[model samples]
Target: MAHKAEDRTYDVIVVGGGPSGFVAAIAAAREGARTLLVERYGFLGGMPTSAALGPISPFYFDDEQVIQGIPHEFVQRMVADGGSTGHIRCTNPHGSGSYLCFYDREAYKWAALSMILEAGVTPLFHSFVSGVRVEGDRVTGVSVTNKSGTSFYSASVVVDATGDGDVATLAGAEYVVGREADGAVQPSTMMFDMAGVDTAAVKAYMDDNLDDFEWASEMVAVHPYSERLPRQHFVGQGFKRLVKEGMDAGELHLGRDSVLFLTTCHPGVLHFNSTRIQNVDGTSAESLTAGEIEGRRQVMSLSRYLIARFPGFENAQLIATGVQIGIRESRHILGEYTLTADDVMSGRKQEDVVARGYFPVDIHNVDGVEGYGEGGVWAGLDDSYDIPYRCLVPARLDGLVIAGRAISASHEAHGSFRTQGGVMAIGQASGTAAALAALGGVAPRRLDVAELQAALLRQKASLRRDPERAREERRRAVQAVSAALAEGRISAKYLADAGTFTGQAPRL
Candidate 1:
């Protein structure tokens, strides 16, 4: 294929069409910037679509809908399309926040595409960004390759929403990979879905065998397994005894010791986030290939073990696996300000806050240590923390901003903001800033923070905590739950839980 240069120029060109990239492009275009979105895959939704990861997390914090704007609107659209359960209170012990949004991946793709196109974003799918076009310290454009050939697309500002920080790395930006101590990144997983599940049998088994779940005592303290199991969406992380038995019987061999699954909008179908492949660097092609192969192998063994030993899986069939292995941790770009663990732990506020992170510091075991069920280390937060605009401005690179999991944050802090909801908020901020910078003929680093914040507010993005709004949201949630109970969309068993529910609106 011959290299070619495109004549058209864009005000903002976003790389990688994941959650962040998808929203970044839309935000830029809606801001009246000539934005172009480049994606390797044919569709959007990033990790949720390509890696089969779902329910979007951390939509709520301290009983309030902290993350709104594009993310909230996206879920509302999905709910209206009958592809999501809307925002429901999370029952899982290791969940990010009080509420999570569960949706169908196919619906996610369609909704994302429709939204971006409606925003006037020019999307170039099935295209991979091969190189960064840099002039001195500033990036001017990117080299993209597709079926037609290699072409150059020039832009005044670039949003690196590639989850791995690919564009920033290529642009000579400083970065750190993995944990600071051992340089080992988090393990990757191959997410899969199974159909024909006997959910009723599974719920009964959970009701009967509380001791099987390591966190059952903590979960039951709030809502019993029976009460939580019958909702429109469900998440479970248990079956420790059965997992041990399978491993002892030489039937299962995976890094995790428990079964982690989430219920989708479809009946009798469950999404599995169980296959764990350790010591794989997502930035390396060779490592990703090996991880994918090992992940599929684990999926096969785990699926077999589940059908043979688990209560509801006796007649279940594996319906689909992720298109790619889910990469939890990757390269973290060094920016003007590196978000620290203390910042996240203390719910630190900043004068230039652009987004709020509500998810807990959830670091999956990099080395697969024993006694860590599901190889997870969870640190909960009482409130959401601020993500400053400086975290998105690369310290050493010009005309570029980072988004998604690749933002400037310590390894521990990254664990929280790396989630879909947080990244989407970060993406919106970055795109809006980029558009403002381009239109004002200023660099991203020199752009005024107050102006950006004002733009976000005008767009209905939540920047600060509001007690009155929180109370209203809680009331709306309660009414939604009550409506669900009244309409019989959920089992009457959930009525007891609904009695305690004080949350947001019914599905949009």
Candidate 2:
């Protein structure tokens, strides 16, 4: 059932369709490139869709929303459709002003498809990039294979949005994998959602037994699940005591100290990101296969523990499981700039900055343990750090720019920039840069930063949202929410999402 090579050419060809790729193709086409987006699966939304990573993180930094442009618009649209929990702040003091938004992954797939089409980007699904035809350091063409056969696609520029940096690697782009100490990446996760639970009961237990729960920070009040009501959401926190009991009794097999869960658009349903399957490198086919099987077993075991022991889940129902195993870290290319941990920790502002990230340096323990030891994690700041334009340009590789979790950053820095919101911004930048490069027939390295910045601003991209002004905005919003609460017009959960503005944190 195989056919001969069919040739096609475009101004830009982007590989992957997850968080970054979804917007990268759209951004490229909007910039007037004849763009094509290729995906291994039938649907888009990448990791969030296939791997079920929910609650997009840190689109905001304290009071200011840092990531803008097409990516912000996409989330705003999802909000209007009741598919998102918009801008819920993490109250933990140790947290990095992380903005959390729980979303419906199923709805996101359709939203991504619609946006890609509306932006005039062509999408090819159920296809994998099987080969790359490179001329020296530049990739001239890519070969993709599907059920029909092999097909070749030529593009003036290529964007590597693959979370693992796979395409760039094949194009002779040098990449580093895992942490510097050991050749091991972060652990993989397989997520699931549960239904038919008394979330109220769960909340009551948590609020009453604050001593029983282990928090990301002691600064965070034991606001229960119901505390996340009206705006109505939950996330990877709650009930460490129950998890410990399960582990001690041999009811649970995972090593994670805290539970990872989130809310959906659906009431009485919650997403769980608890299972940790370590030692799986996502780039390997065999590894992914084994990871999937192991992840599923963990899912079943964890599901059983929830129903049997957890307070909120006395009548819990296992609803759905992720289609693919979620890989946290993988191959990252050496770019013009290798973003360092010191750069991130010092809150370094770059002259040629492209995007800003406010998420914490959250490294899930590579050994599948609960917490970090000596060098595992760094909760550096609650402020924003800019990602430089140089980090997108792969060194010694022409016609290529990297996006998503695979962008050039140290293991610690990558933890922050790898957040979905950060990658989305990087994706938009990648697309715009690629389009400009293709139009002028120049390599990405030679493109002017000023022109790119102007283009991004015109598209409503946010390079900065002044902390003072943003803080004032937060004050006004929170005052309004406080007024509503004073009048007994809004519920506590509803107020939590709006007026409780922990406004613009000081610059680190």
Can you tell me which runs of candidate 2 are displaced by over 4 Å? 1-7, 93-97, 216-230, 372-378, 480-508
Candidate 1, position 279, lDDT? 87
Q: Model 1: per-residue lDDT, tens digit, 408-434?
A: 988899988888889999999999999
- Per TM-score, the best of the predicted structures is 1
Question: Which candidate comes out best when scored by lDDT?
Answer: 1
Give the TM-score (vs. native) of candidate 2. Answer: 0.90
TM for every model, in the order presented, reads: 0.91, 0.90
- Give residue 272's error in model 2 in angstroms: 0.9
Residue-by-residue lDDT tens digits, candidate 2, 42-135 = 9998888888776777676655677888888887777666666555555442322344666778668877898999999989899999888899
C-alpha RMSD by candidate, in order: 4.6, 4.5
